[model samples]
Target: MTKIGKLYGVGVGPGDPELLTMKAMRILREAHRVVAPVSSDSAEGRAESIVRRAIPDVTIERVLISMSPQPVQGRDSAPTGGTSADQGGGTDGYHSKDSGYERAARAITTWLEAGEDVAFVTLGDPHIYSTFTSIAAAVIRMLPVVEIETVEGIMAFQSLAARTSTTVCDAEESLTLVTAIRDTSALERHLTDGTTAIVVYKGGSRLPEIASLLRDTGRSKGAVAGELIGLAGERVTSLDNDEELPSSYLSTVLIPSRSMTKTVEAGEGPA
Candidate 1:
């Protein structure tokens, strides 16, 4: 019997190639071939871009996974006009026979069955709002005995916090991470919940609305927004100055908790 190769889902961190972890780099170097998801055959995806910068000589296999969610009959589909990162993770609770995940999984399975370890690279943490989750799940369903592992990577919120010199949260303060691709009702609720710091992702298009909600809830005092952090066109600005916020698909907004806001106001810095 031939030995099946292990599958590794690696996170390449946010845009910066230098942010790639040592373990992730080692796995990419040792893997039979790295698989990177792309919106189309010709387009280079963000994850692949980071990998190429870090390991220029590594072999990469491109997988076409549409950035937009496909409409499923008789089921409520995600709202349109958001990037793949904005679409959230997983198969959205359902999978189709001819779905992108199915095709990607089949292609990967062939390599795994051939005794070749494959590394599927993703941006940020593979478990956090990453397409790798969907692809890995599909592969597991097909090959039940295959070993799957994940490598952690720095999240955008963490990078944005460092760029803006703002502390994400302190002791006893809850942090809520959410995507603003849909409505603002959930975001509004988080704003009003005392001691909760909210990090909103894919909120570039809804900056104005988010700003208004922050103000209405008094969470806009130290709010900050970052776009393309650690990469080209990087911009980090105060949400108080909405005009300065970059309206890009890679935008991330961090609204500090009331306690942290008080700490900054008092010039004590983060505790």
Candidate 2:
């Protein structure tokens, strides 16, 4: 019997090519085939861009997948329009089958069945709100015995924290991570839930509302927003200045806990 090739889900980190982990680079270079998702045939996905930067001469296979939020009516069918990779940053919401996971899975399966090791490169960590999860699930359903492995990559929030000189959380504190894509209710709740810190993702569209909520909840202090981290047009600024917030889908907002902010202000720094 012919050996079935394994599938590796590789996280390419945020936008910086230098951030790609050594293990992920090795897997991508060694894989029999490398698959990168794209919003359209002409547009290069963020993950693909990072991979190309790190491995200048490497060839990659591009798969078209919708990254836009799916409509309620056609949740199961493929969505029509351009797709975006996870790192491309956009409004966040519940994903649907229309995102084209099944199609991508089928294409990947063909290569695996041919005994070709396949690496699916994604932006950020594969386990964190990544499209890789959907495609991997579909592939598993089709090929039950297929071998799979995941490689961890640095997330945007971590990069944002580093850039802004803010600590995500300290000892005995809780951290809440959410998306501000479709609604701001959850984001509001987390702000007031006694959580030590809150990281809002895909919040570029609702920056104003989020800012208001932060003020109303008295969590506005030390709030920072970052866009296009490690990429062109990158901006990191205080959320206190509404005019400075970049209204791009790739924005990330970090609301540090009041206690931590206070400590930093007093020159005590994070414990």
Candidate 3:
């Protein structure tokens, strides 16, 4: 039997090339090809953009992953749960990502059969709300013996905490990472009495609604947001500004829930 090439899912961290882990960089340097997932909705590849700095000389392959939660054209509505384009790991529960995951699985298999190590790069940690899980799940189902290694990277929220000088949580205070939801009410449901921190991913172009929701829920002030963190032309500002938020699909919002009493004092995010 021919040996299958191993697959590595590397989280390149929250947009700063410096944050890329050593193990991830080593894998990138050694991999035969790096697969960067790009959104069908946009021309940019956030993961690939960050990894390129580490493996500038390696061959980087672009794969289109459907991140949209809107029912894909011509397909029946997806069953409850994810698509690969989901902000952190996979799409939120609204849309199905079977097609996109299957496509990526096929691509990874092709590269492996060719005896090439493939690095599937992601932003932040590959395990946290990342499309990596969906793709890896599909690939494993198809080729049971293929070896896979996932390298962890810093999450966007963690970076956001540092950039804004905001504390994520203290002691037992709760923290929630929210990706997508159907409506304002549903979004509010996640904010528990104990959740001290809430990070909203894929807050793309939904700033007004999110901000309104936050205000309605009593988290009226001291929220921070960031877009394209650690990248050139990156912007970090307070949510207090009247600026239209979600400047890019890559935007994130960090709101301090009512439970938080102490403050870190730095928040540069779009509002």
Q: Write the per-residue lDDT of candidate 2 for residues 224-250, one digit (tens) a residue.
A: 888888778889888765665677777
lDDT of each: 0.81, 0.80, 0.72
> Residue 128 deviation, candidate 3, in Å?
2.1
Better of 1 and 2 by lDDT: 1
Can you tell me which runs of candidate 2 are displaced by over 4 Å?
Answer: 73-83, 86-98, 267-271
Q: Which segments of model 3 are wrong by more than 4 Å?
A: 40-44, 66-89, 93-98, 192-195, 259-271
Which scores better on lDDT, 2 or 3?
2
Candidate 3: deviation at residue 197, Å?
A: 1.3
Candidate 3's clash total is: 14
Q: What tens digits encode model 3's per-residue C-alpha lDDT throughout 1-271?
A: 6578998989899888889988998989888888888766456577877777765676778787775565655755643223345244374544455647788789898888888888998888888777788788888988888899999998877887788666667667778777643344545777646365788876655667777776666674667778878776677766755765655657678887554422422333322
**Model 3 alpha-carbon miss at residue 151, Å:** 0.5
Deviation (Å) of 74 in candidate 1: 4.9
Predicted candidate 2, C-alpha RMSD: 3.2
- The model with the greater TM-score, 2 or 3, is 2
Any idea how many clashes model 1 has?
Answer: 0
Separately for all candidates shown, the number of backbone clashes (residues 3 or more apart, or on different chains) is 0, 1, 14
